[model samples]
Target: MKKIFFLYLLTLFSLNSYTQNLIWFIENDKFGYAHKTTGRTVITPQFTFAGYFSEGTAVAAVGNHLLSSKYGFINEKGKWLIIPQFNAAGNFSEAKARVQQNGKWGYVNKKGIFIIQPQFALCYDFKEGLAQASVKNNLWGLIDSTGKFIVQPEFYSITDVFAGITCIQKNITDKWEILDIKKKTSIKTNFTRMHAFADSLAPARDTSNKWGFVNTHGNWVIQPIFTNASSFSEGLAAVEKEYGSWGFINKNGEWVIPAQFDRPGYFFKGLALLEKGSDIVYVDKEGSLVFSFKR
Candidate 1:
């Protein structure tokens, strides 16, 4: 039994290693290099525009066309593997990417061959096993990577996919609903406004304008009491009282850190950006200030 448990843990680690690392354009403008482990830039800052690295290559823009920037692939050495062609492009996922031509979106394999023809009005990067696409009617829906419609275009808007479920807001309705892709049924909740779920729960606003959280099971683990609330991150959430200051709350809705910061962004990398008047600081879970940055 101990050997079996150890093997299971190893499998989990291997699976985690397969997940993609987030590469962002992090300089003053759209041009930047891939952020690397030594806290250094992978590709030098020379390209006019860049996208995140995926599957060992990145999409970059060349030439000076402000309105018609063309996209091509570059390896770690900044060598162009694929020449600039698509007017717009997204990063590779599942060995393929979505490219735009003549204002329509379609899919292309790593070799730049179109596996799916350009048709949709809008297309998104693949996550989990599906991607979101939009049609002329303005309703968005989910499609498999092969361009097959898994969920028909029925929602007015579509957010990120998490835990095999997608958060969608229907047209002419202010309420947001979670659609189970496999079950094809909406999770029942009483939230008047809802952002996407994070850390297994979503921040929901009640009719009274109070904010709280609800799990994917449509159960309220935290009651609607705070005047404002941000999404949960790293086991803690930020909340604000009516006409009051902002603070951090644990999963149980207890104030782990009291209301003190005049304004706070959601927690990231074990810290949150706090603002007071014109000053900005990074605070830990205990509300103690850690780092400060000038605006």
Candidate 2:
């Protein structure tokens, strides 16, 4: 039994070693990908613009950024899984990507074939089997993978589905409302401003423009007091004080890091980036500086 467990750990290590690292690296004037840890070139510098790997593919464009150009996809090993052809394209999500053809928008499969024909004026990547799209520039709605409208195109703007619901803005009033696609139910809220739910909480603004955290039920979990608030990351959220200073807080509406810094980045990989004057500092969950770099 001990020998079998040792072999299991060895297999896990071998699998981790085979995991591909994709990091954007610039050379000459083009961008390509390199191993995130080893700094080895995975794809030679070729694309004028390159995006990070998503769904086993990455988006790349070769022509003018300000003018018309073709976009396509590349695999982790630098192979063209889909050659450049579309006028514009976004990274693949759920095996589908929104691409522009002629002057209309449509969804394309991983093989570069249009699964949904170009018809919408604008289209976004699919999320949770639905894509936010618009036939007219002013009205937006959600569409299924087959291009069927799950939600009719009526709102002025709609966010991508999150937590099985989407936040939509009315055409005239610009008021934010939550719509549940599964139940086809809409919940109205009193927030003057709102953002999509992240980590089961969304940043919302009251009538006085003060920001706070709200739960999936649209109830304020943290009172509207901070001048600004961001989505929770690594169990803490960054917030701005009335004096324009920034700090991090725990989910229970308690201050974990004092509001003192001028700028703070979201907690990622067990550390958060912060700026003190011209220096970059990385802080851990306990608010202790783990690393620092001065400019």
Please name the candidate that would achieve the greatest lDDT relative to the true structure: 2
Q: Pick the candidate with the highest TM-score.
A: 2
The per-model lDDT (C-alpha) reads 0.69, 0.74
- Candidate 2: residue 225 lDDT (0-100): 94
Worst 10 residues of 1 by lDDT: 10-19
Q: What is the lDDT of residue 37 in candidate 2?
A: 49
RMSD of each: 10.5, 10.8
Tell me the deviation in Å of residue 102 in model 2: 1.1
lDDT of 1 by residue, 1-295 (tens): 4334323322221111111322333243345554322335555566656654677777777767535778877776678877889887776777777888899999888788898899999887777878889977888999987899888888887765778777777875657777788888887556677766778877888878788898887678899898888777778887897758888888888999888767656654455555665455556667776644332
How many residue-pair clashes does candidate 2 contain?
A: 0
Per-residue lDDT of 39-123 in model 2, one digit per residue for the tens? 5677898886666567788778788652465788888887888998888777787889888889899988888888999999998
Q: Which consecutive 10 residues in model 2 have the weakest lDDT in total? A: 10-19
